[model samples]
Target: MRTSTFLMSIIVLVAIMCKNVVNGAIAEGGWMTYCQDKTKAPEGALFACFRSNDGGIHYNGRDLTSSVIYSNPSKANEIAVVLQGHGASAKFWTNDHTVQVYVKDGSSVNYSIKPRQGEGRVNSSVYSSSDADVVIGK
Candidate 1:
């Protein structure tokens, strides 16, 4: 009976997990795939962006549209990205950018950028997209 209960519990847990993943609960924000190498960028480098009509200048890419245009989405309705070097740096487009790429040392973690804090690159500065950061995994 104990073994049966344990197996049933495990099955239930797995079912719930699967349900969440399929229903987008586990992926509440959104899923996006970005290629570092433009040469390898899937044909047009298309993606998505999103926005909030009620908010003030809150827009994030909701979907991919065309070449040189990656319409990336975010978990929050107004997910704004600011690629420092990619943009003019003079100002950040509250509803215009997708994701910002920053440069730092080689001591950063995979998912978190805490250890590499206060560290800067010899050529540029470190940037991130809130918690949705993408670092070069070496």
Candidate 2:
């Protein structure tokens, strides 16, 4: 159907544009950068629960381990983000079943409800535990 095709194209275009803004070609360990986990994610990863928002990458344990944004989760307080940047936390609080992201200028975007029961490819570092294994060692 022409209408279906058109809608698909529009969604694709939006995704592309958002990626350009979020990616910004920032690599591993770069501040304000984005990285994707396009495969099986580790259990207990914050990003594992954040695959719905645009240009959003789960801040990996590796990155957090280095404390690029802070000396440690308990040390230097590093939190420069908008609503869009905290979609995961918002989801936990609102229970609206949608992910919302806020940009530096206060622009916000919302993604549809994920249903919390879908199987999609995510970065291997997304979860702290999947089903049987511990992603981050203790």
Best by TM-score: 2
- Candidate 1 lDDT by residue in tens digits, 1-138: 999999999999999997864443112222343322223223322222223233223323432111122233433433322221222211112232222322123221111112123343322233322233232212
| The candidate that achieves the highest lDDT relative to the unseen native structure | 1
**Candidate 2 lDDT tens digits, 1-138:** 999999999999999998875543222332122122223322212221232222222343332321222112231222211122332222221222222222222222222334233444322222221222211111
RMSD of each: 16.4, 17.1
- Clash number for each model: 18, 17
Runs off by more than 4 Å, candidate 1? 14-26, 29-70, 73-125, 130-138
TM per candidate comes to 0.20, 0.24
Report the lDDT of model 2 for residue 74.
30
Q: In model 1, what lDDT does residue 115 have?
A: 16
Cα lDDT of model 2 overall? 0.29
